[model samples]
Target: MSDVRVHNFSISLDGFATGAGQAPDAPFGHAGERLHEWMFATRFWHEMGGGRGGSGGTDNAFAAMHGPGVGAEIMGAGKFGPPGWQDDPAYKGAWGADPPFHTPVFVLTHRPRPSIEMEGGTTFHFLDASPAEALKRAREAAGGQDVRLGGGPSVIRDFLAEGLVDHMHVVQVPIVLGRGVRLWDGLESLEETYDIEAVSAPSGVTHLTFTAKSR
Candidate 1:
């Protein structure tokens, strides 16, 4: 069965998706990277880079839940934002030599940009279309496989509030952003119906999986 999943999505104790002053200078933000410290020790993460000999523990189990994905992903423009790329014709893509995502990645953006093709079966498609359109295109490209919503808070909340996202995995970290970007800022209405299927992980991070249909 085709499944749309948000795997290993990190969040802070205060519900912040990212820390203050987030920009190109800080990839994960000032203190935002702290949210994903749980995943850093996972064997799955290590294996993704072709590394070996990892500790199998709670963090590993938490990371393992993301699985084994489907085929495609949808992300917001914030994931890769840069004014320089818009001008330089020589600029290929944000991802360096070999990015982990070896599949079709649809980036939601209003400004039109040329489609970027990369090695390892990855292609960056800038979608001027709405979020629904992008997800539809991604689902078709998935070919019956699952489509993941690789988000930047706003995107994920939009999908959830719109009931477009089928399933999601929210992994909460012990840290607090204090004052920053939040995951479910204005989507409190979603809390009434969206049901959490499971909540597990002996690791420091709390893993919560939710399904919209369960409502």
Candidate 2:
């Protein structure tokens, strides 16, 4: 089956999905950049946009999921940024001049915004589309390929509660957040079990594969 998945999402050992104090200026929150330090060290991120000479292994295994059957993506405003498409003179697409994902992206938001056409096939759809609406668009856009729940903790959690995702791969970081957003918050009843498909990665990033048990 086509998947609705969260792959390689990094979180601190302390259980915080993101750091505290988020806003238009600080999207990932104070020192939240630390949350994904492992990603930056990976060759996949480097090939995508991080330039060259980066470590591989963990990031590559995680990033290998990027192209394959993955066809579309859904992200919240916090992940896409600026919240509104009010035409900031300084507005830049989420990842500098261009983003890596060439597939259509549905960005979940409360306000209506215009679409952003980036260099690649990536056209950003500003969805006033609620979580359900966003998922619908992503599924359609996916063209039977898997749709990725590409992030901001609350957004992923919402899909989890709805039992939408078929699989997931999270790369647990060594540090801890102590407090902030959480991946499993209020999701204890989801009736899912992780088979622990793999544990060791060359980059010290643990790769965990999970599913809905019966699916």
Candidate 3:
């Protein structure tokens, strides 16, 4: 079976994945680009933007793992857009016309909508299903490749709680956001089931990889 993996997920020292007051302009809210500054400095990000000159160090090494061998992606509605995006029928997504995920992307939402096919191979399919159900659909669309779990924290938490994730890479940024959406809330003793390894990069962020023990 293809593994379900998460890569380059960023969180603050306080475990907050995203900050409060998320508007159209403030995507990461009060946290701004602090959580992703390390990623932005990576060559992977620069190359994605059709640019040059970026760090080719450990940050780039980690950021570059976001894609590859992933046939589908499952992301939360929060990751799709800011709050109340469902109200706007014209809202495509936060990623403009061409999203980074060039696979079938399944969005978990209470209000499902018609799938939007973008310029690239990426297509947004909204679902009101549980984590398991959504994963089933994504796997079907994956065509025998691994499934990528794209997140904004809450969706990751839900999948973690259900033991649906096989591999996960989390980046702990050296900042403290006192108020925001947390990632570790309700997930206790998560280290037991998964083999966790931490590597501190020179950029002051720690990369934690969690691989589930043989089941």
Candidate 4:
């Protein structure tokens, strides 16, 4: 059976997945790269950046889980681009021509667009569908592999609310954004449905993994 998973999604100490005032120039808004600095120091991230210098520690181990077994991805519109990106017809996405996700990616948006085929086997399919509907499409596209719930907060929240996610990995960065798009809003007592484990990384960030308990 294919499972829905979220890997290495970062959140601030204040619970903001992304900072306020997000724009083309500042993708993560005022929060900047503070939320992802820990990942940047990982060997997995360094390799993604076309470099060969980074730590091979806990962070890298968790970051590397993002790939294997994932066949397709479902992400929010915000994860695909900055604010107002949908308005731009020429938007190639935040990852440029060669995205790290070398699989089918379904972006949830109000305005749907033609599918984009990028380098390294990545194809972006824009869809305006509910969480269940979108997951269905992604699962089909994934063939027999698991579908990854690539998020920018809202998407993950929606899936979690619907009790659709099977495994989730979140990295809690040690910074307080004060204000931004929060990941846990309205999601009271989420731990009740899942077996949650927390591990602190040497980088001061806590790696939280959630596995859905059998019903």
**Positional deviation of residue 157's Cα in model 2 after best superposition, in angstroms:** 0.5
- The most accurate candidate by TM-score is 3
**Error in Å for residue 113 of model 1:** 1.5
lDDT of 3 by residue, 16-81 (tens): 999998898998899999999999999999998889989999989989988888999999998899
Summarize candidate 2's per-residue lDDT along 1-215 as a digit string, tens digits. 67788877877776577777776776667645876777777777787774776776656767667667889989877777644534563454566556877889887776646777787778788787667778888888889998988987888888877777778777777876677788878877554444447586666767667776757
- Tell me the TM-score of model 2: 0.86
- How do the predictions measure up, each by TM-score? 0.89, 0.86, 0.98, 0.97
For model 1, how does the per-residue alpha-carbon lDDT over 8-111 read when each residue is reduced to its tens digit? Answer: 88888888887777666665677756887678777878887789756598667767766466688888877756434556556655676576678888988776
Runs of candidate 1 with Cα error greater than 4 angstroms are 67-69, 82-89, 197-202
Worst 10 residues of 2 by lDDT: 82-91
In the predicted model 2, the residue pairs found to clash are 13-175, 14-176
* Model 1, TM vs. native: 0.89
TM-score for model 4? 0.97
Could you tell me which residue pairs clash in candidate 4?
none
Off by over 4 Å in 2: 23-25, 82-92, 191-198
* Model 4 error, position 150 (Å): 1.1
lDDT of 4 by residue, 1-215 (tens): 79999998999988999999998889899999999889989999999878898999999999999999999999999999988888899787999889999999999999999999999999999999999999999999999999999998999999999999999999999888998899998889999999999999888999999999963
